[model samples]
Target: MKKVKKGRQEVFEEGKLEVKLEMIPQLLAFGLSIEQIAQGLGLDEQVVRQAAQPKS
Candidate 1:
């Protein structure tokens, strides 16, 4: 995974990261699989899987 720069706001400014993060809850609420969300977002399945997991 690429390291995200601290204090950077590029993703927030552009909105792709927010959109992708929001899709996690939306997909979960709709009972969609991680693979499905990943496919829909053109992200890797593992990325979606990790996002779906509870944060420590």
Candidate 2:
């Protein structure tokens, strides 16, 4: 019998909040609205916008 391969699991030692914060920029680059990214990631819109900021 052929075995089906499941997707690889991601392990993050930092925390879920950190992972979600990292995803904010990628989500925005993908053209997702701030509200949409916030809702999907279970974060506040303000938080998403803050993460989208360019750091000096």
What does the lDDT read for residue 12 in candidate 2?
38
TM-score (all chains, Cα) for each model:
0.63, 0.72
What CA root-mean-square deviation does each model show from the true structure?
6.4, 7.6
Tens-place lDDT per residue, model 1, 21-54, is 7679778889988878888888888878888888
Candidate 1's C-alpha runs over 4 A off are: 1-14
lDDT of all predictions, in order shown? 0.77, 0.82
Worst 10 residues of 2 by lDDT: 1-10
Task: Give the best candidate by lDDT.
Answer: 2
Off by over 4 Å in 2: 1-14
Q: Give the per-residue lDDT digits (tens) of candidate 2, residues 1-56.
A: 12322222222334778989999889988999999999998889999999999878
- How many steric clashes does model 1 contain? 0
